[model samples]
Each structure stands twice: as C-alpha cells, then as structure tokens.
Target: MKTKLLLLSAISALMFVSSCSSDDDTITPSIPELEALELSNCSSGIAEGETLILENRNNGVDYIINCTYPVNGDLIIDPGVTIQFGTDATIRVYNSGSIQALGTAQNKVVFTGEDKVPGSWKGLYIISSDVKNKIEYATIEYAGAVGDDGAILLWSDTHLKMNNTNITNSQTYGLHANTNNNELILENNTITACKAPMYLDASYVSAISNGSYTGNNTDAIIVDRGFIDEDHTWTKLNVPYHFPNGVDVVAGGNLTVMPGVIMKFGQDSRLFINEGASGPKPSIIAVGTAAEPIVFTSIDNVMSAWRGIYFDSPNALNEIGFATIENASNPDQEGAIETWYGTVLNVHDVTFKDIQNCAIHQYKFPADPDTLTRSNLTYINVANAFCQN
Candidate 1:
C-alpha cells in the first residue's frame, strides 16, 4: 500500500512538472490490462488445481464463448463479470466440471449474446452434480438457439441451484430440465419475454417456488407426461401447469398436490391413481383449502374435453377435498370422479362443473346422488351429481 502511494505521488509530481514545462504536454499513464479470456481457456486448467477463476475487469464483457465450449474443470465467475456469447455458442460443464457464478444484487453476472437477439447462442448446459454448480444474481438472455433444450439445460441427476436470476428473451423455453431426477432449485427468479418459460418432467416441477413465469409469449408451464413412478408433490407455482397428456400415479407412487394449484389438462387426459395392480396401493392426496381450492380442468373450457380422475386402488389414503374438477367424462369413459367397487376414497367440499356425465360415478351406490342435497359437495352446470355406474 505504501509503495502504491509513493508511485502515485511520483506520477503526480511528474504531471506537475510536465504542466510547468508545457501545459499541452499530457502524459497518459500506462497500466497493464488483462486480455479477454475465452471459454476454451477453461477447457484445460488455467490456474492451479484445474480451476479457472474469472474476475470482474470493471469494463465490457470479460469472456467470449464462440463455440460449444466445454469446461473440463471448475470455473469461478466473480460479480459483475459479463460474458458475450457468439453465434451458436454454448457452455457445457461436463460431469467432472462445476461452475459457480456468484454475484450480488448490485453487481450481477451477465450472460448475453453479442447480437442482442434471442437465439443468438445455444445457452448453458450443466451435466455435473457438483455442489458448487450454482448461479445467483445473474441475467441470462438471448439464448435458446436450438430447438431442443432451453436457455439452461439440466441433465439427469445434476444438482443446480439457481435463485434471484433473470432470464428473458429466449427463442424457446427459458429453461429445460431434462432429468430423470435432479436437484434443481429455483426460487425468486423472474422469466419473461420468452416463447415459453420452462419445460421439465412432472417430478421436477416441484423445484420451482415464488418464481414469475407469466407475461411470456406462452404463459404456461409445459410439463411432460405425468407418469410419476415415485412419491412426488405438485407444488403451486404462480403460473398454471399444463399437462398435454395424462397423469398416471402408478404402483409404488403417491401423488400429492398442494392447494391453489391450477392444473390444466389436454384432451384424453386422466389422473389415474393406482391404475396398475403391482407394488403398493398408490394414492392421490389433493387436499386444498376452501379459500384456495385446487383446480383440475381441461385446457379447453368445453364440457367433457378429457377423461377425469380415476381411482382403481382400494387404498384408504386417497383423498380429494376443496377442489374444482370440471370438463371431464369422455364418450367412452366414466365421469369426473370414478371409483370402482371396494376402492376407498374421501371426497368432500368439492365442486364438480361442466361434466357430461355424473359427477361421481361409483360402481355401486344405494342412495340417489344429488349435489343439491349434499352438504359437502357443490355442482354447477353438471349433468348428474352422482350415479351408480
């Protein structure tokens, strides 16, 4: 520190002397500047221990990714470091590699395209399960160049933590988690101006929380076919979840949906609980509060656009309360809620609407079914309140 001060004092003295000699004699001090680093530099060890450390140069973009660059070692990005990706550029962190792009609210790391347009780059892909693979206080934009994955692709079994980030202007889905099972945490992130916000399997939809996925070109979360073979919870995200196909709660699986979750199903969609006769008796616990009821409806508002919830198991754990199930009962299928003989279920405080068939179609029933007389159930524009199949 003392040496720096002395050097500054000497420079000041020289400038003063130069001013006395000739006011126009201006000397620009020379400071060595670091060259821009490319993503290929990180493919091999740029530092000790096979780690690449990128610091903020307090200027323009510090790194350029021009190809499908592979990071073979650990990479650390400091706050306020900007990375400009060229056409078709992508960052692929291998299984042995990890990336930690830590930034602050005041100084966020930026990953953007040189062309300032969507689809200018291929985006980042994380295939590692390293604990250090985290991205926070960052802005990822102008990605989703390919028709495959989105701005960020998380492979199977990878652990990626992304929070407080902004992802915008993607050509396709903002983020894609093509994983069988991955610990991808998303919290307090905002995604907008993209074609679609996200694409992931049903099991990974619970990873999102308090995130803004609306105001995009397509304002819906596209979840893959809901074939959950394990215990999974469908969390209530701000944006509605659209299931283009059916949801099968097969054996060895239990599905639980949180309250206030708006689930939109396409045609021929059905929520089958314990459909197959193997393993344990699975259940669907879709219990919601009356104030914030869970909703299960077809994407189309017409009547009977899809098959409804079906329960084939005799599991006593099946319960559906304070929910709105509508637009169900196909031509060849049963009603909104179907239960065969000996299947145990607890259905109450629910509203059945726009059904082409009975609200609750049981295989055998003694009393005449009517939601008008029932205290716990409500019906609106329904064909039949309940009936024996």
Candidate 2:
C-alpha cells in the first residue's frame, strides 16, 4: 500500500509541473534574442551610407551595447526601439555623425542601462554640429555616471534639436551645455529625477523653450559663470535660473528678459551692464506684464544675499517694468540698483521687495529713487537709506 501511495504522489507532482509549464508557454510568447552590438571602449564608429537601424527586435531589448558606442556616421532608430547599455556605456555622436531618432507618442524610443538605476551608465554625448542630429519622443534613464557631468552633454559648436523627450533617473544634471556656442533647440521636453534639470552657460539661457525643467532634486537651471555677450531674449521657463556666479552684459550685449522669468543670483553676485568706448551699447529690456511679472532675487532667499544690479550703460534702450527685485544689496551698497553717470534706466511698476536701503543708489552721491523711475514703484520691507558722496 505504501509503494502504491508513493507512485500516486509522484504522478500527481508530474501532472502539476506539466500544467504550470503549459500556462507559462501560453502567457509568455517566444521572443527572438536581441542583437548584441559589442562595442569596446571608444570603438571605431560607423562610416557613412551604412545605416544602423536600432529596432525593437526582441523582448524589450533591441540592441545591447557592451561599452561606449560612437556614432561617426548616420545612425537611425525607429519607434519602440530599446537600446540597453552596460556599465559606463555611452553613445557619442561625433562630428561626422547624424542621428535622427524619431519616435511617436504611442511608441517611444528608449535608452536605458542594464542596472536600471541612477548612475548605472554614462549618458548620450553629442559632439556633432550636424543639422540632422535630432531626437524626439524618446526616454533616457539610468544615466549620468561619475565620469560625466550630465546625462546629455552637448559640447561647444554642437547643434541638436531634441523635442518631446523624457529624461529621468540621472545622478547629475539631465542636460549640460559646455558653452554658449551650441545651437540647442529644446521644446516640449520633460527632464526629471536628476540632480538638476540642466547646467548651461548664461548665454544659453534663451535656448530653453516651453518645457518641464522642474520635478528634479533641484527645480532650477544651473546658470554657469558666463556673460550675455550678445542680443538674446531669455524666454520664461517654469523653473528659476540659479546663478552660481556673477554675470555681465558687456559690449554687444542686449539682454531681454520676458515675462514670468525668475532669476536667482548667488551670494555677493551682481549683474553689470557696461560697454566699451566703441561697440554696441549694452542694454536690457525686461518688460513683464501685470499678470506675469519678472523676478530677480536671491537663490537662497536670504536677506542681502546678492550684491545687486549695477547700471553702467548709457544706452537709451535700457528698460525694466512690472518686475520684482528682492533679497539684494550688500552692506556696502544702499539700494538694489547702482547707477553711474550717463546711465539710462527706464524702470516703472517695479516692486522692490526686501531691499537693504533705497531703491536706487546713484554713484554721483546721495542715492535718489526719483531719478530711476517716473511712477508706479512699490516697495516692501525697504530700509530707505541714502548713499554717501
């Protein structure tokens, strides 16, 4: 009887295993193996005319790269394509390369790391200046390893139009432009889950468009130490522009700050608007609407956190309206603005909030607020002190 029971138990166990195997086969279909693109460290990239199409060939992985992949020619990727990376694996788009990864809303192109965590691999690096280097409707995650500063690093003189891309899970910035010379066109993109949304030169502040720069570890754009040395308009973005260092509007600089634009300056930093003897006069036209006023304040929201704006230009185009200047003016100064001789500043409807002394500090001695504005200037928590001769 014991022998018969043991045989029955073995048969039952075998039947149960067979049922589970049939259910697994029904649930998960057989998928082809992914095409492995074994790339060594800085391998010789693709040449021209030979296109590399990264398609969704297997179960969630189309192409798996072992190391850093270089694109020295045309590299095209279609929708629903998944490109997985190994440790520190990155894709470098070089000067001779052009990548047109056009994905759709429903079927998006994916760039991810094998570990599926932040700092798992190096991110995309675009060093090409090709006009065809564009990427849209894509998702990049688990990038920004220790070797690089950002997940997507754009070198100087590079041109890229990246739209509708979702960048997340980065250990550092989602994007970083090394300098102001790159032609970066960004639109409708969402960058989140990174140290910061981006770190760019002060000259590249206008390259940003309507996108989501918030929802990160720091909801701001790290404006590097640079100057607005050309005529550019800083369009309004959702997050504040955090300036870690001082900036200037030197010769040939005409900066225009649009409505709803927020600028947060570093400690003891100041904005100098000056020009040389014979060049395009430096000017600023910061005209904000009543509904959407512009803001220039301290990054840390501390009292007298920054030095203040200094006007040294004689250009007639210097205009500021419907704005707020706050948390500014160091102990050595007496106002939020320091003006010199021949300076032309047309300021109106501006709310000077949390200022140290007067609203305008005239370098010609005895700071006068009446000399800066015509009317409609409001003050909140201002000391109303005067500068000495």
Instruction: Put down candidate 2 lDDT per residue, 1-389, tens digits, no spaces.
Output: 99999999999999998877854466567675766554443557676555677666755677778677889888989898888888888898888888888899999989999999998989998988999998899999999987697889998889999999999999998998957479888888999999999989888878788889778999998888787778889988889899878688988999999999999999988877877677888999999999999999998898899988888888889988999999888885556877776677888888888887777776653454333444588888988734533
lDDT of 1 by residue, 127-235 (tens): 8888889999999999998765599988887998999999999998899985676888888899999988998888777778888888898788888885677778877
Runs with alpha carbons beyond 4 Å of true place in candidate 1: 1-35, 40-49, 364-375
TM per candidate: 0.85, 0.86
lDDT of 1 at 370: 24
Backbone atom clashes (below 3 Å) for every candidate = 0, 0
Give the 10-residue window scoring lowest on summed lDDT in candidate 2.
365-374
Cα lDDT for residue 221, model 1? 86
Clashing pairs in 1: none
Clashing residue pairs in candidate 2 are: none
TM-score top scorer: 2
Candidate 2 residue-wise lDDT at 313: 86
